[model samples]
Target: MNSEEEFFDAETGLESDDSCEVSFKDATQENGVWERRKKLPAEMISRNNFSVWNILKKCIGMELSKIAMPVVFNEPLSFLQRISEYMEHTHLIHKACSLSDSIDRMQVVAAFAVSAVASQWERTGKPFNPLLGETYELTREDEGYRLISEQVSHHPPISAFHAESLKKEFEFHGSIYPKLKFWGKSVEAEPKGTMTLELLKHKEAYTWTNPMCCVHNIILGKLWIEQYGTVEIVNHRTGDKCVLNFKPCGMFGKELHKVEGHIQDKSKKKRRVMYGKWTECMYSVDPKVYEAYKKSEKKSGGESKKLRQERSCEAEEADEMPEVQETVTVIPGSALLWRITSRPAHSAQMYNFTSFAITLNELEPGMERLLSPTDCRLRPDIRAMESGDIDLASSEKERLEEKQRAARRERSKDEEEWSTRWFQMGTNPHTGAEDWLYTGGYFDRNFTDCPNIY
Candidate 1:
């Protein structure tokens, strides 16, 4: 059978009444307990005057963290706050913990991993590089989780975060040191770190690293982002593993935003095949059905080759490549695992932020009194930027950076080492790699030893 006939068969199967039902509490609901702003105080300004190529031409092949950037390219949030967005899909973790079957639990865990990156769909603005000794804390009693993030390193720019359920059912923590490089028309970021999730009730621990992300058309056309690499998630206690491959966009753009992988048991037997687009949703199907579809697709390869050749010819005649369809075509008998939460209506005017990201920098009434002085909420530059004062934000950013430099010089002159208040350098027990671990005590609210970096 041809590929078109196979697709028709799949569509017919999708209409069957026996499709599986996916259930979970909505992650976007706040339950009237806490209120968050739906939009930023000011809309994003135009970037026509600024030229990224002019600033980045000389810095190609170097780490972008070392280069000083203007506030015009920033999104009024710190990198620490950006990291906290991982918790937006906290319900997935809760769902994983509730499942009894190991394979079912592994499926939910894989869904959680993909959902973590969905927030980056249209987020192109850079987050403010966190200052040394800077910190961010988020307490969401509504969601039953509280997160604390801290900047532990300055030279290499490492951000460490730890989140735990209020009921102590699970813990999620990781330390990321992103190495960003400019390659003429694109900037690629290698997220170097291991993320671990511990389900205390099940005594199961899962560890995985994020895939590499790249922003294309930096010097020419519309800026687009893609994540492409292999992410291997391992369950230390059960020996189950999920291997996911984020496919790069091909010449024909047929594989854009595609992710495919399989789950294997301890004996290396493939149990389930998963396929979907990261931007929209993820689904899992039986290995038998997945194999059958691949065979049919291979049999129709002749037509695909002809189409690719035609597209290549058209590309040489046009200034831009043809637009690819953005939706995922799921196979029949696949169970839905996850879907992205929709953004707010005003998201486009607010740096393309999601509903959760719009509230990351909000300072509620009397909230400042309860926070540490070194918190990112108190950073003058970010505050100014969020309020639409571009001039003040730019000047404040320069002043704070100079102050940090002066402090570093003083410490060097006095032969002193910078001390991190919330986290310490340690080794990850599961991965056996050097990492920054959370040292419990940020919630105690005692700020005596915290540095005054702001």
Candidate 2:
């Protein structure tokens, strides 16, 4: 068994794929996002004592699931930021609204589904739990999209979020409750919920489930994350569906980032195949073209007309591609691939985040002016973390937690409970479960008429 600090500051250094003799300090600062830390936070270090290690070993071996870890290592951002990470790639879903054919829409939705996992790769830091009724909203002026998320329940830790692009006629809404399990060297977090997205123009609705996320090497090695399981997105009205299976990495680290799946009609046997390494890109090809591509792994001479046609369809539609990266445009053909875009820089390099991952916690420019005092974006502790003042961040975090405790005490004494602002508790007709539902409507409601309650 390894000591608590064995991987943190070992004199011999930790093993890594890279040849350079990188210390934990140097490795974490590799991305140049934030300066190297002198040591781990005092709380995290103190919690790593012998008693904590013994408890972790026994509890994890027993597979005592649904257990919560201590909050010492939590990031300064709120859980609302974590929920909004799904919307960072909303442009993909919005594009589905413009496609007339169900096949094209399925492809866009599959891309949307796959993009959600991009932010979780290599990310191990937990976000702070949002206070009851705390809210967050992000409005993209250029994209004409708005996202609103709120902490609707505190006891079971549920968050509800809604996003829409009125111009694109696309909307997404869902609630998430993460089920956590500790396993000695790793933690498994599976979101207990379903999400639905709708395209108003086509009157199409798509629903999908989330996969399990595993945080690896918490005690003996470098910390990172992996997500595995099949995520199926179904278009209820069109009967078109895409089943994406996220491949888990092996013990020796083989097959890292590989994913394969297909899109097919509900009744038809024919399918369009898609496969690729998710960390880089995902490519789609017709079944026949895919078989041919598989056979011609080394030969470049064999190209099909169907592949050329698919390529032309994707390339000709410049409107479907996001303008985040210039390298997004690829040669049209049977191998149509969507590469992950670049993300904003992080404070440390430990998390190998994709381009949009950094924006997950970002309160977009000028958003403070529109935010209410109670909004998570206005939290002092989170702001301190964002600015790299870890000490101040820790102090502010303690202060906020104390404040929350006091508020809860007062509320309990007064027999009062917090309620959500932008969302309402409703029963899900399909699942028969009570969940938070967004009340804002695209065509029926006006934003100007909505109150600024945050």
lDDT of 2 at 34: 24
Task: Quote the lDDT for 65 in model 1.
Answer: 86
Q: Estimate each model's TM-score.
A: 0.90, 0.72
lDDT of 1 by residue, 63-163 (tens): 89899887898889999999998887787798888899988889889988887887887788889999999999976655567789999999999999999
> Which residue runs of candidate 2 sit more than 4 Å off their true CA positions?
1-72, 292-333, 344-369, 429-433, 441-454
Q: What is the TM-score of candidate 1? A: 0.90
Question: How high is the lDDT of residue 189 in model 1?
Answer: 91
Off by over 4 Å in 1: 1-34, 300-303, 309-322
Best lDDT among the predictions, by candidate number: 1
The lDDT, on a scale of 0 to 1, for candidate 1 is: 0.82
Position 92, candidate 1: lDDT: 79
